[model samples]
Target chain A: MRTEKIETDVLIIGGGTAGCYAALTLASEAGGKRILIAEKANIRRSGCLAAGVNALNAYIIKGRTPQDYVEYAKKDAENIVREDLLLTMSEGLNRVTARLEELGLVILKNENGEYAARGNRNIKINGENIKPLLADAVRKCDNVQILNHVNMTDLLLADGRVCGAVGFHVDDSTVYEIHAGAVLCATGGAAGLYRPNNPGFSRHKMWYPPFNTGAGYAMGIQAGAEMTTFEMRFIALRCKDTIAPTGTIAQGVGAKQVNVFGQNYEKNYGITTSQRVYGTVEENRAGRGPCYLHTEGITGEQDKELLKAYLNMAPSQTLKWIEEEKNPSQKDVEIEGTEPYIVGGHTASGYWIDRERRTTLPGLYAAGDVAGGCPQKYVTGALVEGELAAKAIQKDLKESGADQGRYFAGQTAGNQAAAAIRGIYSHHLKKEPGPYSIDQVEEAMQKVMDQYAGGIGSGYRYNEKQLDLADEKITLLQKLAMDLKAEDMDDLLHIYEIKERLIVCRSLIAHLKARKETRWHSFGEHSDYPGKNKKYEKFVNSVLKDGRIQIIYRTLQKGDIEI
Target chain B: MSIRINKEKCVACGKCREVCPGNLIKIGVDKKAQIRHPKECWGCTSCVKECSVNAIEFFLGADIGGAGSWMLTKEEGDIRHWIIHKSDGSVKTIQINKKNSNQY
Candidate 1:
């Protein structure tokens, strides 16, 4: 089809929480400059917050300072979090959330007329339209152009610097070649790498956004950017049947997790939010589970607020509760351990970033779930990083001497780039049919991951033998990716999605194999190495070097650890 | 669990299809929301929320809900009431607020 070329000063991929906020920052700071956001879905309803969220998980309230917040996150991640990034993000968390409120988000208030505290650092908010709110705020900016329903396939590079990115529209199938002075990868995090809890007829049902298939991580890997913490995946303990956020019962109504014997089990493990999932899984393994979030003691007002929290995010949970004729306030709500997912939002699995949110690649930056090292970022921290990245981009533009926005003179550069990208994707248009369809390949990859790479089937437990099998199967899947064929653009999108996932999968396996210790606990349990090892506390960084995956170990610097 | 849409109550507004992130919901020839690929559905329940006529519901599946369970949403101005029918013949109701509706 049609070929369209777009030129901008900044290109933001994936208009989710980070991208939208980045667009807002760029528009407000660098007025009259062209900013483009290329999103696979409609920006107003995309990414993890598409259905909205219940609370600002990273907000620093009055009693807590930024350093205190960072310390809490560092402790939760078992001292593996990037203190520098967390400190910077925490410093801006409250301001960003307040700005969101000023931009129309309704933050719940206490009787004292202050932001109400839900837990230690989180604040309650009626964020039912958080995405739409951010979308509207970005829409008010004149220079920002949002290209909805465009799937970005690859990043464009020249002279060891990122120049732009290329993609195709989901509905129109028009090839889009975008050239930008600076590119921000905010494509959220990965899902579907492992078999979901509800497989078949509901495969897309998972904790994270299903459409966020690790495109950012994959593109970064392909571009030879250093990525970290692929081994420390994010596993959530959610509502059993609906896979809803347990925060509604836990923090919203202050419900504690209880086993089938009606014993409060989380306290036994000295659990943090991330460790709670592990605790729940271990309880189930000990035959104490079929665990439930105990909410029988909450008052009626708290129950109402708890329902409000669910309405903001995962309203289906409330719907399920209503359908099941079970009031959480009247009875304990069942909770289940979701399958492990590759996410930077909860865990620290994404691109390694500097203090300015700049990736290793020149002219490219990353934030939010795509930027690694910062865990428990949630929505507010992502917004803070987005603002940080945007501010950095604006400052860099002013100090640079190179001609900016002039390279996109006409369609030639973009067309040439588009043609080259199309060449890579041309295998999908090949006449020779491959042996496997997209679904078959996906299923095979999932099965391999589930059985070997610490998926739900393995109770998220992996050993050297399983990792070896995962390695072998993933290698075959990568080979199969090259011979894939598609009948149309939709199929082509799936092909690329699988290809990207395969790239991430290989990286995941490599990282999983490198880390011997079971550091991630329930998220990634290695049977061969059953306990946490201080030696492996450093980050497991991986990069695609000369078309091969290479692993590196980076010890956290003194400053990174101590802030 | 997959989303269930009541064809009899549907008015073919297409809001559910529009908000469905996976694009799994389609308007059949009968002008009602139909799931094209039930297996691929993300189960985000965006369709259920966007369906103002209460024509949509979410089934938690036999594995999770253990059969005989149902979920529905009732909107009252700035509040949403969720009513659940549990497998054990119990009922629960929860209310949530919807503030500043016109902002988005």
Candidate 2:
């Protein structure tokens, strides 16, 4: 009965690091035009920064080149990463890192005037928060209009390329096309695909923010963009279930991998080595195992020892600060539960783009954690990709003699992205009766994730049969996620978003299924085929095509770029 | 304009109404705090933080949030998010409780 259409020159899907940087990059150049940022939550409350991490890991300094960053990442990834994307990220890290203070963020400095960094990757600030700071900068910008709690339902395509996206306002329930000539998906990774140790908060321990859900890649796949390396998921291993690095006391803290004797057994099995991502996977493969999804080594006494250290060590930095803030304290922290699937970088589905963060479809871009490829899955990498994508777009538009400002949120005529959203929201799910509920559907999906998808003692231990079972359960969950009810427009969008995650999950499972010779060794954690092989599957990318996903192998020529 | 109360969120145990040093609120039968007319009501948000029901909302916009917060920028409020306590429930701040120097 009513028609609504609007357009923009560029559309960025996620409001995380990449999308925010892109918006900031555009801020100085473009004014008085249209730029619409549709975020699931407020932009400051985005992926990576949502839980307040203090640093960026992908920074490259004056002495360092992109080549060094690339080599470090490749070494960290055990030599299974794309050279071009990693190099591009590291080379551009300084641009993102240096601009934070310029944007009015008050970060702490040392006597040397350098920002505090840990693990030689992250930056530390005086304030114990990240999202609030990022949010403060974003709210001040004039060119951007943020629609928080808005979920992207579909993509608008013109002649088989991405033109824009269609999303629903979850808070009040209205739909907007959010059109732009070029689109970027910075939606971040999927931590919900597997069950994480942090249960009450949802399964997003260290992998990523919970709601990221691979929607960017879903947009890419739906728009028919080429995606790469979806299967190379990162699984962070920790001794305590604290997701460590968060600077908090665990329910218990001890070196992980205790033997049946209940002793510090990881060293005896020889797994405490550095730069070794897959040592544990190899151990489990040989059946010398901590072989548990939820096996943590910290006893109750150990938990008390670690928490007491935090409570008494540094009042400002310790549990006392949390206590003053009325946050949850270690009232006997849940040691690692019986299951352990800390799967990261696994939301393999996303807008397939180049090292420049340009999608295969020109004018459509992707960035942040949502942007596909590179040894991605960190804030710095996302920031680098975000900055690179913005530069590329800014350069392209400037060179083309095109006024990109005139094109913000433009018209879509049968623009398939809008039409798809129209069909899902206005047609398919809208016609259903009052009080349609997707809560039960989401709850059930979580239950399935906890039970079937290598979680809560449910994930297949890399066997053909278990993997096949995981596949069936995933398919069933996808159908349920789609057919589920929606009381409001946001629920439908969330349902649609769930459909995207299921796709990513299947792709992750497919890649996990395909890598017969486990190259990632310990961290990928699929121990059934756990022997490291350099010669067999050098570098593989999972590309979803024509209703089926295929893992094609391609190798870099020897002596291409020395580490 | 100042000290907005969500009646639905409030579970009137009179916690806020009781702790108000400024005597801004009084408990009503509806199980919510009734705000009396505010002329000299020095916008102390002590009652706001005291309410455990999460019924009270604070404002940063001075009139909306009130003048009470900026006025007391110097002193600690009557209520805090989490008051520190040694084994006994004595009111304490972040610094080691000098009163409870005997206790660990």
Candidate 3:
């Protein structure tokens, strides 16, 4: 059979924030050299920052010193953050921003025209358009070529190390292989493992890009890369079953969190509102559920008031409130308290790497939201990590004599990865009538996540029973994934991505199970945790081996780390 | 005055909440519109007519966008539309209501 094969110096997957940044940075380093980006979608629309991101988690803009910011983060995650990681992050912020600025991307600037502060210490970012613009930069570079509308099915392993990937073109089911010196997996995060549509179904159900099914994460795990922080999902307390930020109202309005008892919840919990991270989580655990941040308690009111600076800025929460309180669904769901808006913190999952973006696996590197650093899930963090990984690759390439690595094969891969994808493409193309189509499997997955498994209303209370149910449904999805057929190009991408979601979902379940005490989120209600675990102040990270999950906690022997 | 929503057409994009004169309007489980801060809502159809899903029902009186977010004295029929002012100078907000209820 006629097959397609391509080769490059660097092969990056997923066209979202990390992939785009990796492409751009690689181009800068390998000027006139070749690079390929295998994006399931075109350059302008990547999964990472598709709907815009929440904020720049790592950009310490004006007032906050990297050292001070690091100290604050350490205390917030209950003093479990790795000190070295925090320092690397703090130090790397400016150079990353300057790189973007040099790329024609404009970050909000200060009065002196330097990169402006989103918070006192962080840069105010425009999440909505940053990914596309980054894609544009990648496109403009002559050194990089984006193989769009292609779904990556497997990694090309040279002696158990990632050398490249074999993917199929979504349009006509054409198979292609890319052999590279280094393969950077930036396939964004896995979403679409489940969807939430309680009684008041979403007026819009497409909360996430349908394609971010965690292809990269699956590839890494399958490749034997160690995954971390899989359980500490970047969960959001979604409002009215829809994905909206209560943080917008809480952190924005400085609304004091009063429990149903109307007591001073924050004070009752011994929390000082100045600490933004833990304070909210603790309040929720104390039955403060959904509450307005009181101006008297915290300066969070600035978040709301500051939004007025935007053009015609209106609060997104009001509509969410109307639906939750007024919708006609039989199941009465209120998102005020323990509900979380769970989105994959892609970069949040990888092994604890240094500023150089090195994964524990030599020659394996991670960037974007898929790479882990405490606050590494934002657009800026992903951007910075991507550049750093590329620079590391540059150094490695210079030191090594591995010219045997990275080749462009005009013929597509003929192995398991390529064959696994070919079956799906043919199934969809042939329009096979089966037990489930790709969409059906996806819908099934979403229902399971939203209804039972600590989705919204999960005051950290995912009973072992419900977790089993989620697990059963997850197995069904995996079963369906194997037999499922596709209907179109999008369906083909969706099906394969669903497999990726299963990996993320399985990891998250294990993570949830491992954490005996709910730190940020309460157990079931997601609204309440009785008391602090005082569990050793340590980091909770996860890794996969031989298809099994492992959990680790890193804390100072004292349960709090020494600065 | 309360602006009720036509639940059938609403898509729960939450665009109304972003523009609500009052800090009201939220997305419920079904992804439909919900009233959050009823006291906060100005009873302005900014949400009612502003709703692209057409989920919002206009109340008797709410300063439709462009009418009073700024001192806008346009044609009553033109008032059906929303206009936003940009100080650094840009035109934002699209007035969806082409027919003027004020004239009627």
> Which prediction has the highest DockQ against the true structure?
1
lDDT of 1 by residue, A1-563 (tens): 67787778889998989999999988887857789999887777778887777678888888779999878878887777788888898899988988998888888787799988876887877777788889888888888998877889788877777888999976556888888888999998888899888876556667888788899999899889999988888888888756888875776556788999999988787677657888888888998979998888767766565555666677667655565555777888989888888888888889998888989998889999999999989999999999999998888777773325564654365456668887766657765887888888999989999988988888888898888889888999988877878877767778888888888889998898888998768776889999899998888899899988888888875454311
**Native contact fraction of candidate 3?**
0.00
Estimate candidate 2's alpha-carbon lDDT, on a 0 to 1 scale.
0.52
Off by over 4 Å in 2: A1-4, A31-33, A60-66, A106-108, A116-119, A198-207, A238-351, A399-417, A427-440, A443-453, A456-460, A522-528, A557-563, B1-104
lDDT (Cα, tens digit) per residue for candidate 3, span A349-399: 455565576665555677765665445335565666677778887777667
- List per-prediction Cα lDDT, in the order shown: 0.81, 0.52, 0.54
Stretches of candidate 3 exceeding 4 Å from the true structure: A51-57, A105-118, A125-128, A194-211, A237-348, A351-355, A403-432, A450-452, A523-547, A550-563, B1-104
| Top-scoring candidate (TM-score) | 1
In Å, residue A29's CA in model 3 sits off its true spot by 1.8
Q: Output the worst ten-in-a-row residue range by lDDT, candidate 3 chain A.
A: A306-315
lDDT of 3 by residue, B1-104 (tens): 24556677777787665444222455677888777534223232344434554556432212111121221112244233334333344444433222211000
Of 1 and 3, the candidate ranking higher by DockQ: 1
lDDT of 2 by residue, A1-563 (tens): 13345666666676767778777677656654455677775574445554334334455543557787667666655666656766776666666666766654444455687764433444443222344456567667787777666667567776665566777665355677666656767777665555554444212223344455667766666666666555555555432233333222311232344333344444544432221223444444456555322224435454333332332212222232232332222222212222322222322234445667777776677776665446644655666676778777777666664545544333445354466566666653555543435555555555555554445443224555666777888788776665566655545655675687777777767766666765543334455665766664455555667877777665654333321
Between candidates 1 and 2, the lDDT winner: 1
